[model samples]
Target: MTQTENSQFRIECDSMGEKQIPSNVYYGIQTLRAIENFQISGLKPLETYVDACIYIKKATAIVNGELDCITPETSKAIVEAADEILAGQLRDQFVVDVYQAGAGTSHHMNVNEVLANRALEILGDEKGNYKRVNPNDHVNYGQSTNDVIPTAIRIGGLLALSRTLHPALDNAIAVLETKADEFQNIIKSGRTHLQDAVPVRLGESFRAWAQILSEHQNRIYVASGDLMVLGLGGSAAGTGMNTHPKYRDRVVEVISELINCPLQPAPHLMAAMQSMAPFVNVSGSLRNLAQDLVKISHDLRLMDSGPKTGLKEIQLPPVQPGSSIMPGKYNPVMAEMTSMVCFQVMGYDSAIALAAQAGQLELNVMMPLIAYNLIHSIEILGNTVAALTDKCIQGITANQERCLEYAEGSLALVTALNNHIGYLNAAAVAKESLATGKSLRQIVLEKELMTEAQLAEVLNLEQMSAIRPLGS
Candidate 1:
């Protein structure tokens, strides 16, 4: 309805009551109520999540127009509005907090209202003229929050992976692989339980991390398969209530073509709507990646610990001053930031796990929480990984002199003499070397453990650090 007493506000009526909505906004009464109620988190919905919802609305409108479920004009108007939104218009209309109503009804209505109002405007009608383009009747023809929210989550996850995470992982893997090849001949002391154990080619370390990231990318891809099976046609409670008989398959087909992804209807709409396993599985994969990233970040910090007093085996590119009081000091800020982002991702994964299992008989009230956490986790983790790659991994430079020194001075070098002098004798040589501050070669030659030629061949650092080709 148009504003009666004031020109700046319009009255929007709902079943509960009427509220005066700001005339300038696209969202309506329900969204306003949500804004008022859930001021808990000032955070807005993630952009990919909004895009997911808009895509769903567009697909539904297309199918409904074909089925004559809604008028052709109304469907056209809604689809056009959706297109405008997708083209980066009217984003601020999605104002409801991330912690809104259960099953994301508040946010769902927010989308419906915005599209409805915009469609109304497209048809030469006012924003609140539900009689012309009703939010519930025309815009949301055969859907309910129960089905739409979960399906949005699916689309959002897939979009995030394709647009954000997958590319980041690819870049990181490429950087690490390049580093592996560049550092292939640099040998360093390998540590087990933080003590020197053997020699390792530094390139092998980078190669292993590259392989880890590749595996994580593969796991995420595998987990995303479940997201393709959508609960969209479930409608109100998954009974296909009030939907056109052909709407299920047709809508999924339209959505698949629209998103350019191969999506299918769920075998059991109720099961798909009720279970949050797909999201949980994807989030779990993210957590797995995050854990590995933390380990890698810590390894970088340890390797680049100090310039004079610590390992100093490698140097990370200095992006910014590390300490205010200490000039000429640089820190592993990129790796540190990566670890921080990864820890947040793990936290989001935990919240997603709890929310997934919190669903009850018909629906889960925790969908909003899951939606925000899962999508945000994917985006932030992806961004962090990309930054780590560009800032730290690509710019790393090896300290060949320091690495060689550590490799040569390591007492574990005596490990190679076991076959020549026997275990007890090799152990005695190591003990004496430690006691007398002598080198392993010096002690071994003094004891006449083996001929110099034999000792030199056994203790060859390059041979000891030679990395066997994977799968060999």
Candidate 2:
């Protein structure tokens, strides 16, 4: 070919390559590409980002309907498109990196493009025909990225709680309840300062675990309620600029119906846009739950420490080869994983807290990091709770013999005997039994302190299992 023909071919190829792509994601693509080019932060978009996108689409459709900016047919099409996206139909079409630091402008645009493309499909038109129904002008007619992005983040966080975290916590509570009922009759030595201190039933310890988890469940719900109030109608700077008068309330109503939850408009849009304190509060609550989980996991590990040399009151399910060099050894791998997840949640909480502090006068610029860390915390905690419940808690069985052995060895039970006899006499009986490696029954028999029938009535396991009255 001649030079002119070759140049024309090159130009044709370039135009084809560019034309095949959509322009709505210019900001999203640029942010993703620049971040990839720079390689600054190792963060990525979270699953919560998808939920946020869905919220933006839904809210936009509602606002557009109220403003009458688009035809009724176009508005219906937009709503349907948003529904599809929320149901996860457009996940793959979103290819932008999640690590951008522009307050989720890229994420907002991604949702807009998906809805526009989907709306175009509904109209039998091509994707880039903004003349028919533009993603920004028609779909996102009454909102700004600032308000839309934060609203999406809040909704996404709620979605994670409803779908993943809440169910796992429910399962954990069920496991603890089951264990509590199972261990009701098993007496154990309650320890203080790593030394035996008092007599207690094993069921009581499990009950404590159940109560702690139940309380956290309530806390998570409260934090989720705070998130339900959204900033959708606030527009660019909370003044409702460029938005129709009825836009804010109408959008919130549509979103509430779509999400199947009551979502109120934020009372202070400027504060909502400028401060990430809500995310911080939610993350802090999640971290508090994580800390509790860590303590419970640690206690479970300790309770099931060893089959031979340690307090083997319970047995955990073996998931993998526990050691490389130590043959026939199994480890508490589930507990270790749970501990690590808790620590990660703590670290994510710290990141979210710092990001909240970074917010300034009119808008918080660090929303990328805030969104990243908060969603990461939710995901990790959700997975960890599920794993702990399924792999560790469900299959655990009480080591009855070990529990009995420890209970029998504990001198704290002497307190019960002291009520019937003198305290000094009970201590003497305990000391003699330990010194002679004799059972309590045998020592009591040798001492002849009471008739055999009397001893049987006083030392009965049923009576011993009864929770002693407060002061007694």
Candidate 3:
């Protein structure tokens, strides 16, 4: 199949049949079929995901060229074409719907076609000229969708984390730590079951959140360790069929240097190809992070609840108006948005879990779903954490007076009186204080449960709400 001069479309043929592809586009017949077959989601592949695929193509071209599997001229053209895509050219050529065919063969062919056609152009040949630079023979010389898609997902996940999520987590942890130090002296009442329970340092809350995020960061890193092991070179059902004997190790080495990330070939290629556990592990870690983020966001909203009616121990930066009808209300919009994104990540994780187990014998037909969901979770969670850090966490201010008032008025302070006055007497004093609308100190003094000096020593607000170090 070939394109004629002055034609709007090119005739491209495959084993199944032929289709007319737009002359201007690099993607060929298989990609066109995919575009027509699946219209679900309308979402395209993530840029990092595309880059991951292109990286594999570039590495494979270099390796195949050195191994004499493809001619030097053909390999050079393919490398140049892949470099162009990596430099952010021809992005629109990867137009396959994200929901398309099982095992991501449609998308894999789309990548191969784009690179093959672009290479043909570089070699002074017209598009659709498979004899000049074939998509299957030269571009995807030693790969199958089975091997390539999973490898792409691993690379894509690592790229997304390094470029977006990990840095976001670091910045968020730093911001929260700074806030913890800044608010270390402020005291506020702690609540259990939505009832006042004890006193706590305002800064300690931020410190706890920082620790939570820091721990989550570590867990995600641990889970991502599995991504570095490659099942690539396990072409066509993991038998290394038609692959060069040296291709597996050499390609992994090339990819590591190409992407600037350390990588290795799996000892048992079949197991690596068969198991979707790596993706499931990473997605589960992300879900774990999302759950903690929801808790932190809820805490922020509760602390910044109201100026006149609710607990006003902290104030979040009023980024936008809270209501359409209300004139002078500002909402914790940043934290609210963070919660929503985190919720979405949690949902994506669940989908990834289900898709991971749906894989049968040698390859997961559901790789495309896992790829999109896992990478999407990492990127969105990263972006949301960055926004939350910059807009809300950094701008938060503690209300010193309000914090002091809550710490002072909470009836839970009576718990500190137990050692001196006994539990029964302390309970009696708290009951009297509530019944007569008296202060805890006044009720205790009237009942003569302890001396003023003793009460003062036991009920020191500073001591009661001392800020503890993180992990203490």
Q: What do the candidate models score in CA lDDT, each in turn?
A: 0.94, 0.75, 0.92
Give one digit per residue, the lDDT tens place, for model 2 in 188-224. 7778787765656788788889999999989988887
- The lDDT, on a scale of 0 to 1, for candidate 3 is 0.92
Task: For candidate 1, write residues 1-472 as lDDT tens digits.
Answer: 7686767899988989999998999999999999999999699999999999999999999999999999999999999999999999999999999988899999999999999999999999999989878889998999999999999999999999889899999999999999999999999999999999789999999999999999999999999999999999899889999899999999999999999999999999999999999999999999999999999999999999988898999999999998999999999999999999999999999999999999999888899999999999999988999999999999999999999999999999988888888999988988898899998888878878788899779999999999767997
Q: Show pairs that collide, candidate 1.
A: none
Q: Residue 385, candidate 1: how far off, in angstroms?
A: 0.5
Candidates 2 and 3 compared by lDDT, better number: 3
Model 1 spans > 4 angstroms off: 469-472
Sliding window of 10 residues with minimal summed lDDT for model 2: 7-16
Candidate 3 stretches greater than 4 Å from native = 4-6, 467-472
Residues 164-187, candidate 3: write the lDDT tens digits. 999999999999999999999888
Find the candidate with the highest TM-score and give its number.
1
- Indicate whether candidate 1 or candidate 2 has the larger TM-score: 1
Q: Give each prediction's root-mean-square deviation over alpha carbons.
A: 1.0, 4.9, 1.4
TM-score of 2: 0.84
Which of 1 and 3 is the better model by lDDT? 1
